[model samples]
Target: MILVTGATGQLGTAVLDNLLQHTPAQQVAALVRDEAKAATWQAQGVSIRVGHYGDPASLDRAMQGIEKVLLISGGGEDDALQQHYHVIDAAKKAGVRCLAYTSRALKDPSSLANHLMVRHFQTEEYLQASGLPHIIFRNILYMDTLPLFTGPTVLETGISLPGGQGRVAYALRSEMGEAIAKVLLAGTCDNRIYHFTGAEAYSFTDVAAALTELSGRQVAYTDVENEVLAGRMRERGVPEVAIERTIGFMTDIKHGQEDIVSSDLATALGRQPASLVEGVKLLYKL
Candidate 1:
């Protein structure tokens, strides 16, 4: 059976949805911390394995009877790196035939965004050393997060960020999940890395133009200074950690760190992923 960790999360849920379309529910298992949250999946014939990334014993139990595993990256947890290590170690011990990990599509190790991706780099290294057959997916920024970056009143306030002329190759999180599910179902590990990114890179100015066309509003782009954007976020009561992260992301963009583009996602899906304009429409419901 194939198992997916963080099955209740957005990307994990999307992967499960795609997986169920091509495979029987009985062939799939969900690794969740809370079984109660996965009651619907359990009712649908998916084996619900209760486990925590931080708990090796629980992971061991969850790994039972599972030939393949998808280790979804943890979110915002302080000990997420250690938790990933635990899961990798357990998967190794269980002798899983293949393991897949979701990592970031970052090219520059010295970028300010390294603060966010250092753990992913470490996890990738650890996974490589674990001697388990593995496929590493280096995913780019999610179009799903564009709304968070743009804010609710983006149409009214225009697009304002510290990201200068830098562009990002943003792909939909659900599409990435679909591609990942395809790889999982293909049952090939091959110890290869795939850079899951959109076909083209786009700047905030491009986003503003797309919003203007889609919304019929004259949306504009404003590249503010780093401190200026941080001050605005502070005024909005955004948390310090989040503000720091946002600044780091913008700084990385300014340095062209997120401009990498690749065709791996399209090759996996057998079709082109959504364009920036298309993604913006889906995100805004326009």
Candidate 2:
């Protein structure tokens, strides 16, 4: 049985779509916070288990009868770290053979240039130490950060975060999903770590140009100080840590820390990861 946590989420849903193409529904289990949210998934024959990272009991309940489990991370919450560890513990208790987790690219200890990286590094470390068979997909920054460019708010307001034209090899979450499907099918491969990125690198200028071309609007990239960006986010009610971490991701672009393309996803799924322009056109109808 394959138990997929966060089954109702964007990534989770996409993973399920790919999984179903190659596997049977009886072998799949979906864990969601609201069982009601999975009504559509249930009707289609997925076993829906109601659960949440906040509650260990919920996770424990959902893991029952599960063989492989996908532990997708949740948005930043006070208990984010604990929640992740909880899932690992629960998976252990359920005696799942393989545990697949979604993680960030660049597992370097000093990669905290962003908040997500810090959490991802910690989560990856915890999973490895758990003595469980694990498969981790260290996905690169998502292209969906496109909203930071293509949307009316950023364009209309002329607000650009401080990437300083740094290049990022951003992959589409769909590609991540497709690669994850392959991993799930491949089962647990004894402490496997896959570093997945886009097939090419793109700069912030590339993003700005794409938005300008697609929307026929004037969008300029402005270099704001990281602290200023964090301040703005905090004023808008974002937690301090979240702002600090998110602003730090800008450094990945500025320093070209995220500029390399990799063939990992292609080798894994027998196809190339989507290109930046292709993704923009498909998503924005440009």
lDDT of each: 0.93, 0.80
lDDT for each residue of candidate 1 in 145-226, tens digit (9 for 90 to 100): 8899999999999989989999999999999999999999997789999999999999999999999999999999999998
Clashes of each: 0, 2
Best by lDDT: 1
Model 2 per-residue lDDT tens digits across residues 116-159: 55777788899999988999888888897777533447557654
**Which residue pairs in candidate 2 collide?**
115-245, 166-253
| Candidate 2 runs further than 4 Å off | 149-159, 212-220, 227-242
Error of 1 at 73 (Å): 0.6
TM-scores across all candidates?
Answer: 0.98, 0.88
